[model samples]
Target: MTDTLLKTPLYQAHVDAGAKMVPFAGYDMPVQYGLGVKKEHLHTRDNAGLFDVSHMGQLRLKGANAAAALEALVPVDIIDLPAGQQRYAFFTNEQGGIMDDLMVANLGDHLFVVVNAACKEQDITHLQANLPEDVTLEVITDRALLALQGPKASSVLSRLAPQVADMVFMQVDNVSLMGVDCIVSRSGYTGEDGYEISVPQDKALELANALTAEDEVEWIGLGARDSLRLECGLCLYGHDLDTETTPVESSLLWGISKVRRQDGARPGGFPGADIIFEQIATKAISKKRVGLIGQTKAPVREGAKLFDADNNEIGVVTSGTAGPNAGKPVSMGYVKPEFAALESEVFAEVRGKMLAMTVSKMPFVPQRYYRG
Candidate 1:
């Protein structure tokens, strides 16, 4: 069965380190290492954890009108984005439903986009169909992506690439790490100070080994990655977000840049702009995404039904886990708009019984991104 699965550049390294391999997004990826998920989760919060994320799709959008052409597809201020900076964005359908969430970095002459692994092919096709003749999309297939995350990420990376120390959150730069040319970004999905390094496929294993060789760094698998992001309140595309979920309904209105809003300079040109703007203005969303904290020891998992005080079904749990760092069961799911308030009591049906949960403010742990 594993013979048919796609392998990343670091697949051998993961196996060498005793990683439990699993199928994710058509790739044979690591779900946990010998250190275990709980220890891996705490290690990332306390030190550094290296993640192999090469399955994600990388694309370079080049052309003089690339920024403008891309802006017409998503509700983000892509035109005004300063060079060497990154922004979070998503593709919206005609109904204002989010197709996928992605990160866009202005690379001066072009835009560097990192999209969800599962949606890459679809995203590439979408861009190809919608973008004008002036813009050319190049799917980067020969590069591997690695994420070094934690409070000590900077120190660990700076040892190999001193220039990375100068970069702040959301900043991107081309630097030579261990003599290898790479694109390094001071950004990551985990709510921690980190660097996402894009290196040549041939040099990926060498770079991964160098980073893991650091005393403060260790191999972290997908299990810990999920828990870390969950504690940080980050959304996982297929689960917490989907094509039918609009940004407003997902409580992701902040991702819609101010300049692209109804009152902003270049207003309402993207797909579903009219519907998204109406929802923003009228505050008429039926359900909204919110953080959930299990009041009991039992973990409330995805697909679990949620209910209100009167036992009325309100929503379903999208993601949940025993947060090693948060020290409890943390989850995020959609609930009726009226029951989305912080401290609001809700019940999650687990194992044929309702488990107590509460609506909580997210980043159940505080975000520690280095903004300076």
Candidate 2:
């Protein structure tokens, strides 16, 4: 995976903006613009910020049984997904672990899927290996993905594509922006009201320039993107989640519809369904992912062990950051279910010292999605 560094269609655009380039998932990506991470993170919360996420993989799955085939991989009810609707899903391993988390959209004629850049190749392979012969997978490498996020995101985007102004959260549709055909989705990762646009690679720079030129939209980079998602209590792939983690253990049970669990419409169709469904009914999972707020300013990073009040090693921090909006250091980690109660006193082992932390609720900042 590290053999060659890949560049997105907007590579030159990022350099032109004076972005600090770094290697991410084998791609040369912008870590931060001159605005810096803190300001960019706050701007995306108060105003609008544009992100070049073209490094992620987009694919089209088609055929009469595409939904059914996709359901076999993830726990979500893709077959029940309405046209122009998007659903968050994860590819589960046979042993009940997650292969990767992804977003899937029912585009009527086909399924539009976006997977993490790090796991794209393996995700495609897994899908192809399990899907029926009739199902088809098409890698949409000709497109660039962009995310415009913040409270004012919609107002700015509406100026260029007013039709999307009516689109509610998790909705997707083909639209024209700057006279270029693109797929626009009413969703984002920053826990803010926003949209993700999939534009043709050839027009990537043109669209990036047009959007960033807007007063409300400033160019954001990977650094702000990470801190933003972290503050939102969202998981970053390869950090908060991995092949060793299961949806149940990660407290993602809400994503697994009841119809697929206990005595419902279609129970147990996907991989590890028995184990997952059993955990749902019995609540037997050992560890649960929880939010932690550092009682001090010292932020804990990944790999920091967590300890119970009794000084017993209980868990480890998976993702952490100085929560800009929360005005404190916040983190996400997995702990034994017994110690996961809200407000439970725990200690994070940071540099040989036990720092006080409390088990807090996620979305450290309240989510502001425009569901309507």
Candidate 3:
């Protein structure tokens, strides 16, 4: 039952804004407002949309050995990450399977990390259990996060925090917004120019009110967030990624650092690095993730079986949606390596009938991140 679900710091604010609340990730979240998912999705693509992402786990790891301790868990080059910059990374199991994908930013004295909401508890336990006694984990439960995204996001944010105007994509630092200290990161999951603001819970409403008061900013909900991320080919933790899948199979090998993967560098020390590096060199994986476009109007749903021309079961759909911007049904799933090639024709069995589709490239819509 959703009765026992938790509420974020913005729970009352969402209700006051007339949000359609639903249970998600053990929290009551807004699925949409009166604008509907399509308009909300487009609004974020064309203008700035404020999102309540306080449910995501925020943490800080500190100590002289923190960076080295973290590098032992993730495959990214954490030791080389410059202060005020963030790197994308994921936790791996001993078998090279993904435990969770996350963002890590170097804040000089400590490392700031953000993990998936559903995986937060276990992630914290995993990190604490794995790190040495010298390293300490501090959970920031008093902080709430807001994501402002789209083409006009920069202009809207600059009005309140002008120093952030100079911040480029993937950069992060503490900035004052309306006199409230906030950790503003120039990054988002929507594949657009945006900022993720972390503010004290007591001061969160003030920050949210100020940003949404702008003509360019409006409240967006989780339904649009999912579709937006899907359109960008960003994977959802439980669906596109799982404990049984490796980074190479999920098309996330790009997130692995060159220094960690190649020889002569601090290489292959993280869990499952042997299998992952072997897959990187040999390409022996049987299946891989690829994008798909529906030739028909039917929107393909998840778990629908994918088949070859001979009707042999090849793979399963992981994520799908009617892309509002692309004006076509876009989806992502795994298929055999031979069928993973772009433009390769395949059939998706939807409602017991085979529908034709092609292996298409991702980010079905173009990304507009403001990287300097």
Candidate 4:
């Protein structure tokens, strides 16, 4: 059983700081510190909060054919990505179904990849067998990830690393903060202005301590991270998306570049291209991932069934929560496209009670990303 429980470099620090640890994505991580989930969730929205995301997978893929080699596995037009820019993409199966969502950065000579914590090991193995022998897949397991997010995040980080304040969304730059060399990205899972910093594992604690030293900074845990991402309408890998779901049905067509969709005839040779391509041409997609606002206090959770007013089952809830930001229940799930309109009435079977809900626009709370 110990093999199932993974630990990040900050495991000891989490325990030392009195974090309420729990098993998540195979790692024993802090679900919440002494403040609990609600307080931590609000804290991140109102002020800058630090999150130890070391459990995420960081990899460096290097070789002459790196760009072309990776293009064969993912749908994004990686060759088009210029240096110092990053984009969100996914590892797809032959059926065009998503294996996992990932962020890829073209570092000029190589590709920098960050995948979900739960899918890291499998992702590494998949890349190893698929890429050309000349290309090397190097795992940066000795590094740690920290996300500093909120309106004041830039201000807090600027105090130590003044250059970060100028970074636009999705841009990456390598800089030093308080003498520690780091790669900072103006990106985050939550729809808020934030930075995801990659630092040496040994230096993680010191950096975290330094960031938290400011009056506006506090340590946040996974509990708040989940709620914040949900409020932002971001999908959680295992929950909102899965291997069985395709990008088209998941409302992620934007990830497929127009060049690949039109000029290339075939965007990528990754899994599921045929079906995905056919869907793009024929609009065979029957369902869509949409947001829901429940009228009752009961929080609809994963596995809840959805039905129409006549009580006809239409689809299943993939992810849901009583939104911390909305102060009411907000959820996301796939429903038949015919029933996915903004005002369509739907019911989520909550604890045997069919609660009323309406199909609503996402980002239940407006996104606060600093696009400029």
- Candidate 1, residue 42: the lDDT equals 92
Clashes of each: 0, 0, 0, 6
Candidate 3 lDDT, 62-107, residue by residue in tens: 9999989999998899998999999999999999999999999999
C-alpha root-mean-square deviation, each candidate: 0.7, 1.3, 0.9, 1.5
TM-score of each: 0.99, 0.98, 0.98, 0.96
Model 3 residue 10 CA deviation in Å? 0.3
- In model 3, the clashing pairs are none
lDDT of 4: 0.88
The regions of model 3 sitting more than 4 angstroms off are none
* Candidate 2 wrong stretches, greater than 4 Å: 1-3
Quick one: how many clashes does candidate 1 have?
0
Q: In candidate 2, how many Å is residue 8 off?
A: 0.5
Cα distance off (Å), candidate 4, residue 134: 2.2
lDDT of the candidates, in the order given: 0.94, 0.91, 0.93, 0.88
**lDDT (10s digit) by residue, model 1, range 82-139:** 9999999999999999989999999898999999999999999999999999899999
Native-referenced Cα lDDT, model 1: 0.94
Q: For candidate 4, write residues 322-347 as lDDT tens digits.
A: 89889898889999989988999999
Model 1 misplaced stretches (Cα beyond 4 Å): none
